[model samples]
Target: MRIVLVLEYDGSNYCGWQSQSESCAIQDAVEKALSAIAKEDIRIVTAGRTDAGVHAFYQVVHFDTLTSRPLSAWVRGVNAFLPEDISILWAGEVPDDFHARYSAVERRYLYFLLNQSARPGVHHNKVGWFHVPLELETMQAAGKLLVGEHDFSSFRAAECQAKSPVRTITHLNIVRQGNLVVFDLRANSFLHHMVRNIIGCLVYIGKGKYSADWIDELLQHKNRTFAAPTFSAAGLYLAGVRYDPSWLIPEFSDFPIISNGVLR
Candidate 1:
């Protein structure tokens, strides 16, 4: 049977989501706990691959197995063996055709940036910080220019292995309630370092380094080197992944109520 699971993890300590040679990868830990339950090898595929120091509020994955257990077992049982940073939130039976990566229609990300003089202490790895004050007005103007379908080559990583750089930005909203600026972006899909790289450019504009229209030029140039350096990964979060309603997967696209001095 095919199984789908929703996951939430603090990626500060893990070596990202994809399994690597090291045991510190989130996939290695999840597969280990799952293998224990199945009494056989268990491999899982995720909707998105987050870089190191990135967090996820709602990450989706799917795995296949012959062993049958209640859906709760995949949740509660798996959490028993998983570490404190990782967790299994929901589990359900999925059709053989359902895929965690390919079935996804849209993905949402929330970036928490501490825009203050003193660097963040309590939110250390949880947020990206910039000492200089940023203009929310200009950033919002620049973000609007980024909406719609375009070849995002300028904001993509040089080492990204994705075949196409053409991804649509369905939405991009930047809001700040104090020193914290929250970037809410929705895309059909994202390339490696795409969000962080875009954040770098937006920050550049917000800090008066570039005009709002500079992003327009970057999109036309399609040169990765012309863009700003990729911003810190600490602030990025895989907040949500949306799928077709026919699939019956849960919806978690809304931003959560944040406190803890990070938002306000």
Candidate 2:
């Protein structure tokens, strides 16, 4: 049977989603719990791999197993052995051909920035902070330029191994609520550090360090050197993944609720 799982985790404690030899990765923790339950080693694949300090509200993964267990076992059973910071939200059987990563049509990410002079206290390490006041109107204008298919080399990390710099941003929006600024981005796929890099540039634009048109110029340049530095990984969240209807994955619409009871 092929099992699919929706996971929610506070990535602040782990070394990212992929299992590493160091045994500190989220995948290692999850696989350990699963293996203990199945009494067999289990390998899993995820929809997307988030970097260190990044959180995930709905990360999807699938694994094949010959052992037969109730669906609830995959949820309640596996979660029993996992740490409090990681959780298995939903679990179900998927078709043999369904792949968590390849089958995903679009992925969504949300970035939260505390845009006040005062440093975040309770929310520290959970959100990005910018001391200077931000100009939301200018940032919104700059963000609009990133929507659509484009070669996003400027926003990609130097270590990114993707074959191409081209990716399509189907949706991009920037909005401000009180002292919090939210960046909601949806794309077919993302390069390493892509969202953070873009957010750094947006921050610069918001602070009047760059003009609104600077994003367009950066996109046209296609040079990583010309873009703003990568923003903090603390602010990024793997919001959700969208797959074809045939996959029958559960639909989740609510944004992640963090410790402060703020919805991102």
Candidate 3:
């Protein structure tokens, strides 16, 4: 049987989602736990790979195993052996055709920024800190220009391995609550460091250092150097992934609420 799992993790101490040769990774930790339960080697595939210091609220993965364990065992049993920072939120049997990565229809990401003069105290590795007041309206207006399908070469990382930079941004929202600014973005897929790079440019526009039109110019130019530098990965979160309803995967409802107000 194939089992699908919803995972939540703090990426502060891990190398990233993918397993690495020399460093600890979230995938390695989870697979190790699951393998212990199954009493055999178990491999898994994730919906999206988050960078180092990037967190995930609802990461999805699937593994094929012959071990006939109950859903509770897969959840609680596996988590018992996992590290404190990684967890298994939900687990269920999925069809053979259900893929954790290829079956995902959309992926959502959220970037949290502490925009205040003082540095963050409690949210040190949980949020990106900007020691300047940000104009919420300006950031929202600039984000709108990035909606729809376009060549996002300017926002892509130089080490990006995506075959193409043209991805559709179905939704882009900016919200602010006190000194916390939230950037919510949804797309079919994203290139490497795409969200962080976009947030860097948005921060520049929010600070009034660049006009909203600068976003459009950067998009048109299709040059990575024309855009702002990539922001910190601490603020980035893999919010969720959408799959076809026919797959009958369990639903996740743990997305953070924008408490203040929606800017756009």
**Which predicted model would earn the best lDDT?**
1
lDDT of 3 by residue, 50-98 (tens): 9999998789999999899989999999999998898898898988989
- lDDT, residue 101, model 2: 96
Tell me the number of clashing residue pairs for each predicted model: 0, 0, 0
Model 2 ranges off by over 4 Å: 254-264
* Model 1 score (lDDT): 0.92
Q: Which regions of candidate 1 deviate over 4 angstroms?
A: 253-264
Model 2: per-residue Cα lDDT over 1-264, one tens digit each:
999999899999988888888998999999999999988999999999999899988899999999999999999999999999998988999889999999999998989999999999999878999999999999999999999999999999999999999999999888787999989999999999999999999999999999999999999999999999999988888988998887889765643354333473
On the 0 to 100 scale, the lDDT of residue 80 in model 1 is 96
lDDT of 1 by residue, 24-52 (tens): 79999999999999899999999999999
Minimal lDDT window, size 10, model 2: 253-262
Candidate 3 weakest ten by summed lDDT: 255-264
Sorting all predicted structures by lDDT, with the top scorer first, yields: 1, 2, 3
